[model samples]
Target: MSEIQEEAVLEQDQIIVESGRPKMLGYVFGFFAVTLLGYFLVNRYYMPAPAVNTAPAVRFAPSELLNDLNKRLAYLQNRTTGVSFYIHTIRKKENLWKLASKRHYSVHAIIGCNPQFETYDVSIGQKIIIPSRAGTLHPVQKNDSWQKIASRYKTTLPELVKYNNTALDIGYGDLVFVPDRRPDMALMNDKLREKYELRALFVSPLGGRLSSTFGRRKHPVTGQYKLHGGIDIAVKTGTWVGAAADGVVTLASDGVGHYGKAVFVDHQDGYVTHYGHLSKILVRPGQKVKARQLIARSGSTGRSTGPHLHFTIKKNDVSKDPLKFIW
Candidate 1:
């Protein structure tokens, strides 16, 4: 009975061990499969895809691109280095030509820095900024563009931008340097141009009350309306009258035409001055006279009503208002 029972138990044990071995092997294989699948899924989600081998349509060589970059850097440096500025105080006998000659700069450069000057004439004690290089300092206005500025100055846009060492964008009131350019006097403001022209005229010969203005008026002697060629300034007989400008006396005669005891002076430049109704003549024909020099005496002359001096200025033989020249 013992042997039979032992044999049956041993057989059952062997079967159970074999069956458990297969189950354990399956579990290990399943665990490894699941881990391998998870690894693959994670790689697909996180890792970058391989790059395609497509060529670009346009390609620059490395050397060429590098050279271009270096050139740009050098140009930027040169543009920055070219700019410099300093201020100067004007002195007597120092004109723009002299100042520009000293610095090897142009008159335009000086005028560009001093936008406040209405005329080419510079006064003593005037403060002006001088640029190291020749250029115009153009003030940027509203809606101003590099193209517009360049066109106005008759320069290229790239050159203008390069001269300024700035971007194409310029804000209002910004001063942009235009290289090798001058201020366009014709483009100057009307008031400023007028002021410039007015300064070019001769100073008044002498200060006196303006009894009559220039233009068409009722004739004092004829009592008829007509354009008076000259202006009548009332003065006592023998009152000293001076030359209005530097000139050569063309004529000094008594009772000439309507101008009684008149003296005519030729100031060149198509300008001529007439002094009529003189009590005495202090100058002779073909005699050179300076401005403010005593040339004649005032008196009733040239069809006048009372003691007065008749003065006239002619440009190219055209009569102009005396007040415009003397006042």
Candidate 2:
């Protein structure tokens, strides 16, 4: 039997024993209704409600953390610190010479604008501050070699060693300054402006194409292949030639063995320069010269077929590439 029916029967039985006088049907129904009502009230008041679920849990990713750390490190690495200053613009084709010639500016000041130019050519519309003079030429604390010093200055080891009269392999802990100046390039610039007024370095070597380089060649006149000491830029007779650097003219004589009307210059920095094969010597020996100053006119004065500028640079009596010192 169902619980509610059984409970009702039990109630009737109890009523009969008490006084068989009562009709108990209604009483049993009332008891069942009361039990149901009490049960509902107890369940509602005593039981806990269910928890409502929301979003999913997130996982910790190591790679993502690493990427964030790297970004922060890069930011720190790129951060700069120093006193800053303003630099003026340098126009196209402008150089230290032009800068030195300016009454209001200086070549050292031009050194400050280095980082602003992308190439050897300084451009317009660029902004930069002239850098501080470079680290006292070279340091003194360590026994520095030529190679090390050259590397520190954006120069070559050979150039530094040659200028210092030192060997290729200089020892360490032997500190040496190798004696340097701005090469006085600024002075050359100023002088060139004052005298020549030509806004260039080399004057016409010849009116002809370069037959060969300064290293070696079969001489056009002799034909016995020998080490050609200088460049042979071919031109017809009577072409003009000029000095490549400022100095004092030393030799402007001769239709001798190889060099015809030759001119020599003592540039005074342990360097002597030469220009040969001229039709005419305009400046005599011992005359002061500026870069591009007219020294002679080109000709086949030397044992040469065509006129040309036979240019050479010597340091401590050894020949070298003249291009390294040009402007």
Q: Report per-prediction Cα RMSD to one decimal.
A: 31.3, 33.1
Which lDDT tens digits does candidate 2 get at residues 1-327? 999999999997886677643546667788999999987765434322222223222222323312343332222122211212234466776665465545344443443223122223345655433323221123222455444566555555434432332322233212222223232222133433332232233444334566656677676666778777766667767777777777898787876457777889887556787777777889887799987787788777767666666777787888865543443
Cα lDDT listed for each candidate: 0.70, 0.52
- Quote each prediction's TM-score: 0.43, 0.38
Candidate 1: regions farther than 4 A off: 1-188, 195-199
- Model 1 earns a TM-score of 0.43
Kindly report which residue pairs in candidate 1 clash with one another: 260-302, 277-301
TM-score of 2: 0.38
Best-matching candidate per TM-score: 1
RMSD of 1: 31.3
